[model samples]
Target chain A: MRATIIHKPGDIRIEDVPEPKILRPTDAIIRTAATCVCGSDLWDYRGINPVDEPHPMGHEYVGVVEEVGGEVTSVKPGQFVVGSFATSDNTCPNCRNGYQSSCVHREFMSTCQAEYIRVPTADGTLVATPDQPADDLIPSLLTLSDVMGTGWYAAVAAEVQPGSTVVVVGDGAVGLSGVIAAKELGAERVIAMSRHASRQKLATEFGATDIVTERGDEGIARVKELTGGIGADSVLECVGTQESMLQALRSTRPGGNVGFVGVPHGVAIDGQELFFSHVGLRGGPAPVRRFLPDLIDRVLDGRIDPGKVFDLTLPLDEVAEGYRAMDERRAIKALLRP
Target chain B: MRATIIHKPGDIRIEDVPEPKILRPTDAIIRTAATCVCGSDLWDYRGINPVDEPHPMGHEYVGVVEEVGGEVTSVKPGQFVVGSFATSDNTCPNCRNGYQSSCVHREFMSTCQAEYIRVPTADGTLVATPDQPADDLIPSLLTLSDVMGTGWYAAVAAEVQPGSTVVVVGDGAVGLSGVIAAKELGAERVIAMSRHASRQKLATEFGATDIVTERGDEGIARVKELTGGIGADSVLECVGTQESMLQALRSTRPGGNVGFVGVPHGVAIDGQELFFSHVGLRGGPAPVRRFLPDLIDRVLDGRIDPGKVFDLTLPLDEVAEGYRAMDERRAIKALLRP
Candidate 1:
């Protein structure tokens, strides 16, 4: 099987790897139909996150089950399924409470970029559709595994209400998707911060009532201006940088919420500022599995077409090029068909 | 008029000061019947927070209205009243939404230690008793002005559930009162972190089910051990420090909440750790004015006696000793009868 592997910074390659097999009683082997390069992958590719060894590259995917272990009851052979970036035994107390990402026994699904991937905790991790999804639904459904679910979690954590003025702080696929989530959750106004023309268009299409082309303080100023100088009622911080975090904090009203979905990279929050502002901060690695079922339904019903985020697509053999495209900002997200 | 002034670190003086008079159309001069030294006041007295000048102190009080400004309507002369540390015009949008501490026109009652103090925003800041209370109710009514209301806000922000386990991260007067609030809010178990024997005793009396003598990581471990390694459902952090913040985060379940009421000093939060923990953090300078009325009712009905926190008493002229008792840890809190 061909899989994407990173040997080091700037050294992404698609190489022949051994085929995956069910190694656990709760495992399911899926023949990957689609996978994609994630925004986080660029971190390793750009040398921001050092790759100590050749490691599996992607975590988001939609696939058809080729085989299932005896303990896997929810998904079976020939079924189309979507799984979260983190695998969890949904029976755990944490998972039962919808914090599956923090499940006591959790596994990362980074090997999904390969032609065949083994998914553990299959019964609790994988959600099967009523039937095989159409080819057009594949990309959208693939997004439910990570990006869309994460965006939804950000919105939920931010407590976006019907009249909430929401500000999304990142313009990546997840941030763009948050615009949709905030709107879907009934936010009265959605503001997307993006300087990219292509990303701005999608943000507008996804229900962003306003778009702030500025970054940092200027972006916060625009948000405050849009909110009548009171700042946003809810802010979804999708970029985990010091500047982004500070902007999110500065742009939120006192007693408002900042729901962060971005994987923080050395960002530190001043407790005094958080305390004095009275802003409620809640978020971590998103429990994407909690929202997978709902997101899949939305995708199937055509309520959202998150697949549009994949501005470039290629065969699994071109995974290196896909990584390069996203790494260089030439593409918003890249889809790889296996 | 007599007032308590912090002349230097660990030095307090009870000295003569000008009697306060109505300074604005919205101000009222209150002849304080009772005032108390707070845990936060010691921050400056201990030099943890520097006091560059010999400033008048104390922010918690219950009093008789001695004089009223032309525009003061809700509270009139000779009326008994309990008001929050923060004086707010409750007509603002923030106040209407139950966040009076963040009200557009908010004022901190800085010199409540004085015999007569001018309270700004008097009409909306002070909540009068339905009738003049008997002498015995003064102690409990004084508690409603700050400590009790702050505790209730912490419990509310933490979202204590009917059968949840609650951990209070500080055992000061406010934290002990939080135990009362948690019980009132229906928490099944309350754990208080305290090393002082007197504070521990008071905590148990206030409804603490357990007491952890350790701080930070060890304290969190004790809480986890008590909760079957799952952590508490709600944690109230009444001491704002990096250690207390981390303890609050580490002691809460993945989906649990940490309600912090401590004024943050030099605390800084690691974004990645907070992101991965999945705990909800919310709190600020408490919206005490929002809870004062209901708490006053609870106090008046004899349902809760938070005045037990005040272990030491002094006349207004001896307020310097009140500050000394609290600063030296000889008293958890002290009351000054003016």
Candidate 2:
């Protein structure tokens, strides 16, 4: 099986790796239908996150179940399925609380950018489509595994509701997906902060009522100006940086919320600053498994077209080019066909 | 008029100060019916928060209206009222969002311990009682100005819902009030963390179902044990220190919330730590003004008696003794009568 592996910074390769087999009674082996390069992957490709040792890459996938352990009952062979980046035993306390990403028996999907991937806690992590999804729905369904699910979690965490004024920080695939989520959740006005003409265009098409191309202080000022000088009711922080986090916090009204979904690298929030801001904050790995059922329905229903984020696509053997394109900002996201 | 002044750390004195005059059309003068020393006041008395120079102390008071400014019409002279420590115009965007403490036109009541205090934004800040309460209700009504209202805000911020398992992480007056708040909010189990037996007794009387006397890691373990090893649904953080904040965070389950109100002095939260914990955090100076009407009704209806937190009482002139007693931990709180 061909798998995406990072040897070091700036070194991504497709290597011949052994096919994954069901290692646990609850595991299921899936032949990946589609996978993609994530903005988060740039962390290692750019050497922002240390590459201590060579490791498999990618955590997003839509696939067909090839094999299943005896204990796996919810999904079976030949079924088209979508699973979250994080695997979970849905019966755990955290999973029951709708935070499957924090499940006690959780394992992040790290080897999914391969021909075949082994999914643990299959019954809880994998959600089968009503039937085999059409090829056109594959990309949208694939996003439900992580990015789209994450965007929905961001909107929900920010408490977006009908008549809410929402601001989305960042213009990555997840941020663009957040624009759709905000609109789906009935946000009256969705503001997308992006400087990229292409990403801003996509954000607008995906339901952003306004776009602010500024960064830092100017960005905060712009959001405040649009929100009657107080700030939006909810701000979605899709980029995890000190500046982006601060911008999200400052761009929200005192009683509003900031739902941060980006994986924080070196961010440290000052306690007094947060206290005075009076903004509610909740961020972490998205509980994608919790939203899989509904999101899949939305995808199948054609209510949202998240697949548009994949502006570039390539054969799995060209995985290195995919990584390079995203790392260099040449592609919003690159879908890989196995 | 006489007022309590902090000359420096450990130097609290009663001094003759000029009487307050209407400085704005929105101001109203009040003859202090009762004022109390707060735990936050100890911040300056102990010098943790620097006392740059001699300054009037005290922000909690229930008083009788002495005179109103030209534009003040909500209350007239001779009416007894309870006002929040943080004054708000109650009409700004932040105030309309129920974050009155963050109002555009806001002022902290620093001269409340004096014989007479001037309250700014009287119409938006002061809530007149149905009638002059009996002598016994004075203490509880006075607490509505800050402590009780703060506790209610903590519970509200923590999202205490019916059947929620709550943890109150401070033994101060505000924390004790939080216990009451949690119960009132319909939490099935209320856990109060306090090592002092006197405070523990008060917590129980205020409706705490259990008490955890431990602190730090051990305290987290105890709370987890009580909550089936996943931690509480909501944790009210009333003591704002790095240790207390971390303990509160660790003691809440994933997807839980921490409502912090202790006015953090030197706390910095690592983004990665909070991200992994998956706990929602919202803190600030409590919007006491938002919860005033409801909390006052609770006091009047005899559903709550937050005044019990003031175990020590003294004449207004003995303000120094009141400060000393609280600073030395000889009293949970002290009430001053002018």
Best by TM-score: 2
Candidate 1 lDDT (Cα, whole model)?
0.89
Which residue ranges in model 2 land beyond 4 Å of their true spot? none
lDDT of 1 by residue, B1-338 (tens): 88888888888888888898777999999889999888888888889988898898989998999999998888888899999999899988678778899888987778988788889999889999988899888888898888888889899889898998999988888898999999999999999999999999999998999999987678888999999787999999998888888999899999889999988888999999999899989888889898888888998898999989989988877777877777778998888897
DockQ for model 2 equals 0.93
Cα lDDT tens digits, model 1, A1-338, are 89989999999888998998889889999999899999988889999998899988899988999999988888889999999999999988889878999888888888988899999999888999988999988988988888888899999999999989999999999999899999999999999999999999999999999989988777878888888777899999999999999999999998899999999998999898888788898888789889988888898899999888889999999989998888889999999998
Q: Which CAPRI category fits model 2?
A: high
User: TM-score for model 2?
Assistant: 0.99
Chain A: TM-score in each model:
0.99, 0.99
Docking quality level of the chain pair in candidate 1: high
TM-score of chain B of 2: 0.99
Candidate 2 per-residue C-alpha lDDT over A1-338 given as tens digits, one digit per residue, 9 for 90 to 100: 89999999999989998898879999999999999998898999999999999999999999999999999999989999999999999999999999999999999999988999999999999999989999999999998998999999999999999999999998999999999999999999999999999999999999999999888899999998999999999999999999889999999999899999999989999999999999999999999999999999898999999999999999999989999898888999999999
Clashing pairs for predicted structure model 2, backbone only: none
